[model samples]
Target: MSRTLFIIDVQNDFTEGGALGVEGGAAVAAGITEYLAEHGEAYDLVVASRDWHHADDDNGGHFATDAAPDFVTTWPKHCMAGTPGAEYHPALDTSRVDVHIRKGQGVPAYSIFEGTDDAGASIGEVLTQHGITDVDVVGIATDYCVRASALDALEHGQHVRVLRDLVAGVAPESSEAALAELGHAGAAIVESGALPTAGAGAPEDGDGEAGTAGDRA
Candidate 1:
């Protein structure tokens, strides 16, 4: 089985100092960096997802704008395309990333798989073309992007695992709910340390840490 790691939305816009920062988002980058440094060579593929949007786009317009009325359900404007906020957090080690998927360019794309290239290839399609079957996911805001990507991977028939320790959330309650939903949808929740060592056997059940983001979910 070809194994792949999908790092989802570990961008500056979602972390501590950005426009729409989530609680614990910075920790996601730190944890993922640690995991990659310790197990960089274990996976055959490494991919990342980034949210790229335009300031005047519909998604961005949903938030308060000097030119538009504020929508109660909308969030703050963030992750403008090509800006520093749209880039992955500086702490995440991107040296091993073989693919980078940019999402939410013109729409409310919550899933990395929803991202398409100029030629219309999806993240899933790219992974399929690359022969990746087993996928592990890590990144920010467990209730949103991370959960959506993991579910989309499972739907694509890939064996999916969520790195419980390497994710954060906009809120604890919603994050917990999302994790339970992912588990019910057949995603394995695992800790970074318990990931299979290269050439070692896969675990019967993906080992997860207590009190982690997914645990609250």
Candidate 2:
């Protein structure tokens, strides 16, 4: 189907017990792993993105420096570069991920499209290089990164499907509203269970450990 799976910010900082931990975030990570175990080959590519903010400064004012975070435009310090909070969640099996995307380097970013690969290719560029016409979106903070990434995918002219069950949001109400917005914007909100078999399948453990960041996309 010339498709790709987008794994949004499923990092420690956004999961339970981190800087900006959300409810059910850890479950989403583990659920994605289980789904991939059975349907990893359902698509041609799998890409994962993480927030890798700079720890030195306020990250272009994304992180509230001296004042309390308002949680809307500004937030508490999180996902610092090279820290554990920036790494993928422990339960997510990143072994199958082919391209590792890191966003929010020194600025505020929500969409995966705003990030670049280690090779400096944007997500859209990578998808075009691979001829990706379809994408399945899943991950943490359904109302934020997941929502933004799905919208950008649509703007990129790719058919987008958001795996609802594989995502966790900052708040239930906001998450529902985000899904509605995505649907209205032309994204298909679907459950992962209803998807057809996919993936070309990659070797286990990748170039890194089974769940380590060495080869995580």
Identify the candidate with maximal TM-score. Answer: 2
Clashing pairs in 1: 176-216, 176-217
- Model 2 misplaced regions, further than 4 Å: 199-217
The lDDT per prediction is: 0.79, 0.85
Relative to the true structure, candidate 1 reaches a TM of 0.87
lDDT of 2 at 79: 97
Q: Write the per-residue lDDT of candidate 2 for residues 1-217, one digit (tens) a residue.
A: 4889999999999998999998888888999999998898777899999999999999889999889999988999999999999999999999999999999999999999999999999999999999998888999778899989999999999988787888888887788888888877887777666665554443221121111011001
Clashes of 2: 8
Clashes of each: 2, 8
Q: What is the lDDT of candidate 2?
A: 0.85
lDDT of 1: 0.79
Candidate 1 on 1-52: residue-level lDDT in tens?
8889989898998998898787777777877888887777778888888888
Taking all chains together, the TM-score of candidate 2 against the true structure is: 0.90
RMSD of 2: 8.1
